[model samples]
Target: MTTSTAPLPDSFDPDTRRVPPLGGFNATMLGIELRRTLRNRRTIIFTLVFPIALFLAFGGQEEWNTTVGRGNVAAYVMVSMAFYGAALTAASAGAMVAVERAQGWSRQLRLTPLSPTAYILTKALLALTLGALAIGVVNIAGVAQGRPSMDVGTWIASAVLTLICTLVFAALGVFVGYLVPSENAMQILGPGLALFAFLGNVFIPITQGSLMWHIASFTPMFGVAEISRSVLTGDLPWYAVLNAVAWLGIFVAGAAWRMSRDTARV
Candidate 1:
């Protein structure tokens, strides 16, 4: 006597398994990422509070009331601080991937239908959300202080530009997160960004056409800083825009390369 065996269904065949289209990139995945980021209390507090503290400390000087352009110098400092906060927040959000990767989340994600492009896009959106929040917090603080003065339209444009340019730092954070160990990623990035801010003239205004000004133009933060201030000064140099676009491209390419290498390791 012989026993009869039945063929399994297609769903039971590993080779024929179907994946959701587009690697399951959707609102649900983005919401999950946002929630996970919001749950990190340390990141939330630092990202939201640190910049406001800096602004209050540095932006309230009596000398800053003197006019620089359409607005007072206080408004310039406010925009600068806003940009810094956005960059810091976006970068921190992007770097959180290091913790996830350390937890073998990347490997788990590989087993799912999540594509690299989808993952990157979701992370970028999360960074933007955090960046905007940081910018808003600092801007509100500026308004509440009633010191930083600018035309309302210029204020709105500068804030928007600052938030948009922060995407460069978001890419930088992702690249660094993938390049280093989780334990050291933020340790290096935190101080490194402060250094970049100093060099990029975010913390100090370099004399235009001076040697230091030329050097600052090449730093990652310079483009964003200058562009964000352009609305107030009415000076939109092509080089500042180029600086931002170039750094953004470089960081994004680096992130994509690092992500591919990381995925390969898994």
Candidate 2:
């Protein structure tokens, strides 16, 4: 008869074991995250439906075929809704940080060779990927509905600008995720961002030189709204550009600070 026994402590030496760093821009990790994002039904439905419904409701009118800028009203609304969806997707994914933390995923990662920076970068990239998908879906819907014509260059520019601008919302997600429970995160961000979208000239065009426009200019969503829409107009507002950059900085800093605190305690 043979018996199995637990290994004695002296049979293992800590000096003989080495764990390589698991932290980095890993393609495999990204692929897994991408799959997870795609499989998330709630995220997919919410991110896709809201903007498309809004576009169908407001963008289908013949009155909207008239030019708003260099592009017609349909194109403007399409772009606005596209970016709106992108923002929502990125923000929601970023806020998953809270859920992961509550589930002890963050602590588990801390025990591994993964670096905090790598973890954050991975989450940000995942959010951005989903954001891009949201933009693409909205634009596809616009095209299917026979949206007004615009230069190919303008279409490409607007998509790229919207993609880049979504980074701020991703950071906001992380910041909120770290600060609150997962259940509360989206509850706060949903209505809050909707209000920001309205104020930022996304759902409706705020009259130029109006007090609402002035207030919208200072809000987080306004800069992205202005720059994304400028593709049709060919006029870049420097103040809005600065506003976008400033908010991006603040969100990035806040996320980093919270992440550091969490990791430090671990």
- Which candidate achieves the best TM-score against the true structure? 1
In model 1, which runs have C-alpha deviations exceeding 4 angstroms?
A: 1-5, 10-18, 264-266
lDDT of 2 by residue, 14-54 (tens): 76666666555588888998898788887897578877888
C-alpha TM-score for every candidate: 0.92, 0.89
Residues 203-262 of candidate 1 have per-residue lDDT tens digits of 887898999889889989888788989998888899989999999999999988988778
TM-score (C-alpha) between model 2 and the true structure: 0.89
Which runs in model 2 stand beyond 4 Å of their true positions? 1-22, 263-266
Question: Local error of candidate 2 at 226, Å?
Answer: 0.8
- Lowest summed lDDT across 10 adjacent residues in model 2 is found at 1-10
Candidate 1: minimum summed lDDT over ten consecutive residues — where?
1-10
